[model samples]
Target: MSSFNRFRAAGPSSLMASAHPGGDSPALRAVRTLRDAASQPRMMIAQPFGPQGERPESDPARAFGANKPHPTAGWIPPTALAALINGLRRWIRLRALKIIDEIAERRMIDRTRTLDSSRHVSDHLLEQLPVPVWVEDESGRLVHHNRAFRALFRREAEALIGRSVAELLPETSDSIPVETRLDTGERRLDVIIGRCRLTLPASSPDFRSIAPVGGRIGTITDITERKEIERRLRELATTDDLTGALSRRAFFAAVEQEAERSSRYGSKMSLMMIDLDHFKQVNDRFGHAAGDRALKLAAQAMVEGLRDIDALGRMGGEEFAVLLPQTSLSGAIEVAERLRKSVAAIAIPVDPHPMTVQLTVSIGVAERLDDESDFDRVLSRADAALYRAKDEGRDRVVFDQPRHRDIFPA
Candidate 1:
């Protein structure tokens, strides 16, 4: 074959071809000469020394002695190529598995972080709430309660969780009508439940019922103290400070009510007007302080002398009025006499020397004759009788006698 054809067929597969043209060719002689020139003395295989100038076993490519590689064949070894392909496949599969495992691990870590974050935020929110909040599930069992609810009942949040609303509150709380608005602390709270309902805002849906999800949520506050404060404020507005009794305005209002009641029920009522005798002299001698003390002492004596059903009031400076419900004229007179004696016998403490002074009061009693006799007419009659008592003596009780004329001129 021509050199061109041989070269083309050989390509990269003939790089290790033999150099010999023929057994005795000149090219073979040149190759042999080159090998002889490069040869060196060395130990023989499994022998202490060369027996007869033999070549060493540790020479390059001595695997098959004197053997030449065939041309037009692949360069790679058959066994080595098989192992290399297997190694490559194994590396590729290992890399793919590593990548898949890394992705799965990252997803797991992310889910764990999300769960932790959600729990942390929920705990933080539960602790910060102020009002007591409880949530129950559809089965009327508690799902959760805020820190405020736990603190209010002096219990732990965990303890209240998974409990029923009935377990936490009394039966009265459960009986409340749903959708019915009610107030707890003077104002109404919006509540919705199986029985009770209020119109108010809730921080959580649980607050509206014992369980929010078909269960209910509940909250409680005490309003009795606030209501009592308002009631006392109203009472103070119409009370006299000196004697701790009703002022004139309150007295008239009460008497009007009593008058109406008496008229409606056909029950008799008596009114008495009282005046402290020599009050001005007491003020002039021992100062107004003594007069004030005398008034207090007289009030105490009158309060002690009358029944609890009777209403007594200070009718402005040194004068007092009384309303006796369900009393006849004779009974009114007896009550007035007792009040007069009680006031007359009271010893008042005065200033400077701290001297005790015995004082007296004049009383005039009047009874309602019929339904037509109103507060005004009763007061007028009592006033007329009061003047008569004062005219008769400084310290005495007098009954209403319209027929009796004033001792002095009008």
Candidate 2:
């Protein structure tokens, strides 16, 4: 048998002997059976008695030369009882240690999760920012910068942190002139920094700029792309793709805007509606391609005839419009006559035979009145004058007078 099994076998037997004072207790038999079947001494440790007629730590009765006197008919073994108490103590200690270990492990896990969550949240905020932002202390020392700023500068966040703004950006070191004051009460430049070229050590030139406000806040936006897109969109919306003349929608919108500005600024603004004469016949005689060439030629002539400040737009089919800001009614009519003569003089070359197409335009001009703010009323007057020009015969310019019924019927 193994050492533990032997210990187990002897344990309850020893207990049974202790229990039987006269060596004949009834409980002695039951305790003996427990010791014989147990696999380990520890398992038999739960028995309930000490050695018979001996203390818990004493040798066996045979070695001690002890003989038991009969006392009680039924008694528990003292060795078994002592062993049970010791086993209970061991179990309690093990359970307490297990509980402590679990608590420590749980606390460690919670700490790690808290740190990870904080870092994740911080990274997300940096990436989502729309504008470049950087924070610095009162001493102009960089403390925090978002991802936008890092990407633009091509630098790491760690390298920039704790560095002085002046030290990191030598070009902008003197940007804060002597007159401006930062939030830290130190004098610095308060103006926006424009794009300045920078030559790197081993590469072509790069651009850098800054928008530092105070020691604490800085924000910047690269306006190069924004400006370019805005310029292109404006050109497409206003100017005709083929002839470079303003579109119909842009023409009326300009008239309305000019009217409002004139009323507010106490300036005169005029509108001229022009139509090409015999434009349909040109297309009917030649192909549609020839007609397109004639329209482009007429538009160019009208543009050359007007002032740079005057706005002209193509109003679909053969009609066009002109907006004259700060111009009088007579001046508007004179300008329309010039445009008509210019179109009549254009010799549009469209064929291999060197044939030139002749064209003339009819015009209607109207100036804004003192109380005129309604765009619809102004346009009606201009249209009426245009019909009058065509009625009196085409190839002529007509001006509309400000009338009560023309503006508002009584």
lDDT for model 1, please. 0.69
Per-residue lDDT tens digits of candidate 1, residues 6-63? Answer: 5434532132223222234333333333333323333223323356544457754445
TM-score of each: 0.57, 0.52
Count of backbone collisions within predicted model 1: 16
Over 4 Å off, model 1? 1-131, 135-144, 147-211, 214-216, 222-225, 371-373, 402-410
lDDT of each: 0.69, 0.69
Candidate 2, residues 156-254: lDDT per residue as tens digits? Answer: 988897775446554542232334234445333322234532211111111122223444555545545665687899999888987789888888788
Q: Candidate 2's C-alpha lDDT?
A: 0.69
TM-score of predicted structure 2: 0.52
